[model samples]
Target: MVKPTYSPRRRTGARANAPSSQRTLHLGGESNPGRIQPSTKAAPIDTMPITSDPALEPLHRATLRVIGKSPGTGLVLPQCHIASCAHVVGRGTPPGTELRVQPWGRQPVEVRLIAIDDNADLALLGPPVDAPCPVELQQLMPLPLDGQIQRGDRFAAIGFPKNTNTQTIQCEEIQAEYEFYTHRQNQPSLLKLKLGQFRPGFSGGGLLNLRTGRICGLVKETRDEYQNLGGRAIPIEDLIAFCRHAGLPLSHAEPPPAVASEQAQALAAFLQQLPKWQDLASRRLFVQWALLNHPHAGDYQPMGQNPAADAQALALATLGPGATDAGLDAARQLLQRVLEEPVGKATKAEAKRLLKLLDA
Candidate 1:
């Protein structure tokens, strides 16, 4: 239960959903307002976005603004997979149902329902055949999921809340690690949480553990009222277990391939130094080098950028970090495709090496 507190930017005042920053999110649905919007500062149109929160860095593209069962959020993980709550995507939603997802500032793309689990309230979707990814920034190294949760630990989630003029992200604590059963169900798969301004769009969002820089749960329920403020989420165990049973890459080995706690900080630091998705070849090479903790890793030219958008870079990050096999296949697929096209020797060689490593 070591809550590592190296938070250089512990959000002290001005919660993201404070009245000053809060927007309208009508409970009616997506059209209630429109598809949720990404933070201009987080995902700028003219320039690239940068983040100090190591835990949330590299996640902007991963956490997409979705309009599923309603105007809820979604997570676009490695292997071209998207995970969200069945409720938000429409519980009992049949496979083959086409849904549209709009990444921060990207255009809407269609995804097909590949799997759904009603008992667990989780659903998995796959990208269109013509499209390789739901979002352009595919080098998405999502934080690994912690096996368990302890009471009083701080957790955060980003989503499209109802009545919010703009999409918002919120953080709170586990009021109780115990399971909570709802009036609609017989099982107690949901864990209680201290709700803030979380509204409708919060469903299906991943609950991140602020301390370990790992995900701990899948948000399924939330309350907006400041008075009866309580929320519930499907614990990370259920999410991982479901991913495993579905033969997905999300939980690959279920260890910590996404990134170790110490490395997550290092990963975020390395990302902060760079601009934002530049020089695909160098960025891809740098990730593998950095993940291995090479001494001269930062010496690479043009260091101030975020490589989260590079699919190959993501493979390198996934390959080395906690050594999770999540993005290996996806990255390998993209690199193989790139090889078919004419490119520089360095780029070709690096792509080959990354593909080989993923194979190994």
Candidate 2:
């Protein structure tokens, strides 16, 4: 991944050799001086691994995974439109290259690229007419409309980091005054944040307020190690400007209440029950059982399609807060089956690890 330019320094020469991820050039406008780094370039887009029971939120339903030869992240807006970094959505690839969006617990949908403003480093994507219902945009918190944000305000971010798993960073801070990206034309304003050690693939995701659950900004870039691990984001005002310019409808809804703790409890119960689950579709069936039978049903969406790695994911999820009595009994049975069956070394090791956890 390319590091973003920092120090608020003036550009002395043209950046022709910079990685495409950092090339935030203005389209159809005069050049400006600033730095840019696309969030999609955080990992290889082609190697997206599937995991069962991702513990997604309703808000997360609107956060789509953008995949192509160049994979990235996108957010479903009130217009049923997907918003992402221009570099991520507009990057050129081989012929027939298409943008595929995978919503939480649903089939992937292909979208039509609508408008791209390189100066703002923003792109608007609309779903095809035949595509399934757009993600739940109403669950998202629209920023500035809810209230004013200032320095020291707490925030959170969720995105498909490394094109592998859904990861989140909670309790990030607004560290500096908002500023414009002077390097691109029109000089769009961006939010400055103190996000230490951010993961890759969070580039096009929302910077949601911790208190109100509203989206304050769209993550843009991260500074180098010398710059103390700071990051940049496109402020909500800029996002509004893009929507208006693209003629797309924008929603200004209040974000829902926080549900992290509730979700955690539900996940714990589901993981605890998964070991004893012996069915044709263990992951989905087990999670469904927990959601319906446990007290934490409101906290989580049921598990989606199961894969071979699901056993590993279930084992890992169980590590937090440990397992229940029923889980230990089920785990023992599962591990015995694995030991008696013909599976790979990795699977065998994973089974051993899970047995140890159950014993613990």
Candidate 1 per-residue lDDT over residues 60-86, each given as its tens digit: 445765567665777765587778888
Q: Which segments of candidate 2 are over 4 A away from where they belong?
A: 1-58, 91-98, 129-147, 163-186, 225-228, 251-360
Best by lDDT: 1
Over all chains combined, what TM-score does candidate 2 have? 0.45
Q: What lDDT score belongs to each candidate, Candidate 1 first?
A: 0.51, 0.46
Question: lDDT value for candidate 2?
Answer: 0.46
Residue range with the least summed lDDT across 10 consecutive positions in model 2: 11-20
Off by over 4 Å in 1: 1-55, 129-131, 134-139, 163-185, 223-228, 252-360
Give the clash count for each candidate.
19, 5
Model 2 agreement with the true structure over 75-130: per-residue lDDT tens digits: 66765677777666654322223466655433355666666666667777776556
Give the distance in Å from residue 197's predicted Cα in candidate 2 to where it truly belongs: 2.6
Q: Write down the TM-score for model 1.
A: 0.52
